[model samples]
Target: MNQPSSEGAAAETQSGALFLMAMLALGTVAPTVFWGLPVIVGQIAQQWGFGAAELGIAVLGEVFGMAAGTLLMATVLARRPLRITLAATIALTAAANFATPFAHSLALFIAVRAVAGIGAGALSGIAMSCLSYTKAAERNIGWLVLLQVLWSMALLGYVLPVVGATAQATGTYVCIGVLALVFLPAIALFKRAEAFVSAEADNSARVDVRGVMLLLGCIFALYFGVGVLWTFLEQIGMRAGLSEARVATTLVYANLASLAACVVMPRLGHGNGLRRWAIINIGACVASAAALTLPQTPDRFAIAAIVFIVAWTGAATLIFATMPRVDTVGRYATLSPGVLSLGFGIGSAAGGELIELLDARAAVGLACVFCCVSLLCYVSLGRAREAEQDALARASQS
Candidate 1:
């Protein structure tokens, strides 16, 4: 009897798999509530009478927890059932977010946010794993990026402001908690999507551990630069004399630019062009960081914001897309989020300290340095991969 080909089985499950991917992607970004916290950290600090360092500590707690969760998923939980993992993580995240509103002390707030991060990290790992199993990672990830941008626009541009305006930090946490609950219904779809992985060709090929490590290093450095800028972007704008509202408005345009990139990226196809695009994106990021260091005029700041978002989104999506190709088993893909989160945690704390000790310009300078380091790591990884492929071709020919 003829057996169904892997490609044929994949086609059969494509629609359901994509749907599950979308849910997981959405779950992946649902944790952006933590990202948004920096936007209102000033208000929280004033309410609590905490300094920049203290606020940073709180943020670091959540970031560490997220990294920890991702590490667990990539290692210990790697063999767990997707459906069970997703459900358990989402439930825990929702509970932590719900409790965030009640945290009065700095210690309590940090603890709860850390708890939320653990759950969020696990969810992100599951999402990345599922996405890695798909036939077209770049296109699917582009779609995921678009979903994330739209969600961010809605939450940051409207919901958080409106709700937080009335109830302050409490209102923000409440909205995040409620939003987390919305994903509970999506958990069931994971079961149906399990077939996507089963249908994949048995890639028993050994992974290039050293090469993947370099790539992960690049991811960490790239996001570290991003974390430095992103965590303090609004505050930096205000320091440059823009009103809070103006900063928010500028960020809206940035998000829009990111959305446009998401639309365009998938159409570009997954090919050698990915590396070229990555190079271009990193250059743009460095340029954006440099521009931010210039005089903070409205026009200059707005343009830089747009440039940063477009470049960052494109680069990040490419990294996510490229990881599956690097390690077919999705091991690196599972670890990518954790590595990026760890970078973010370190960058955020370090950026905050730089701002306090030196100035905003110093933080921007550090970000540029991180981007350059990332570029170097990426170039090395590319060379290693090319050599490996060439060697494999030679062996086959012989």
Candidate 2:
């Protein structure tokens, strides 16, 4: 038998480690621009003379585009060089954002946002694929989540408000466009080794297609619940009689709580125990969604917001972390964002209709139902994994 040399193994590990860090940084920055839209939707509405219905339509367009882009990248573009594909996607995103400020009509605005979403979704898929190459996936994913939340807080709490006040909605779009351009230089880090990692992933155990499908379904349902509340979180606060400033402050606090959850996730590690944590988080999310139906008070609203953020963030982190471990080839991991984006698009559109027909509280109640369905999916996923393990063990004994 020919033994692999120690030096060769060390070099491979170093290269993989470098790719992991670079991917984390890219993931942290790219999505922040698109994710900041919800934070500044109020300013956009005022500037463009739109309302909740229009905003919901815009969000739906963007997330649907994201789903399409991620599907394309993971399937058709999967064999292409990672560096070139990522660079082109980022450049396209920058161009789309740059054109956003010139969109005078709602139709044009939605088109521009959809284009940007395509690029952002592809970026997210590539980043998740790269992270799946690392050995300690759960820990690194926790770090990725932490960095993303921190950046989101900065953009939402400080940057968007200042720019919106001065330049209104156009200024916010301009800032995001410029920020996208800044990431163009980071494309060089994608390197040839990434292709090698993707190739190695191809040789791993045969994909559990049924199991993977179930997991993706769960992810879709989970984010759908999140989107139902998130698409109108600010409006919800305002409806509760809170001032704009107070609502913004509440959002900042909620993100801070999410940040704290990310910080604690790595310490928990990965195991069967994660299922228990996920269940607990889902339960908390259901309670928070229920609380949104109650009468309006700043204190009650803030408490509910914090609880929702912490639980949702923690649950999402666990899901992302578990994907690479279960699939090992990164294909399912790459497609996770697509599933999530589709869910967001559907949830936002449906939530808007619910809010219009009934009330904000009614939309939240529907969200709680989605969360319960997601919980059932999680249980099914656990059973499937256990059965697979038992089958493999018996085969080995034979």
**What C-alpha lDDT values do all the predictions have?**
0.74, 0.75
Q: What TM-score does each of the candidates earn?
A: 0.85, 0.85
**Runs of candidate 1 exceeding 4 Å displacement:** 1-14, 17-25, 39-51, 192-203, 234-250, 294-302
Give the backbone clash total of model 2. Answer: 0
In the order shown, the candidates' Cα RMSDs to the true structure are 4.0, 4.1
Global lDDT for candidate 1?
Answer: 0.74
lDDT of 1 by residue, 100-123 (tens): 877888899889989988887777
Instruction: Extract clashing residue pairs from model 2.
Output: none
Model 2, runs deviating above 4 Å: 1-21, 46-52, 196-204, 233-252, 291-303
Residue 122 of model 1, lDDT score: 74
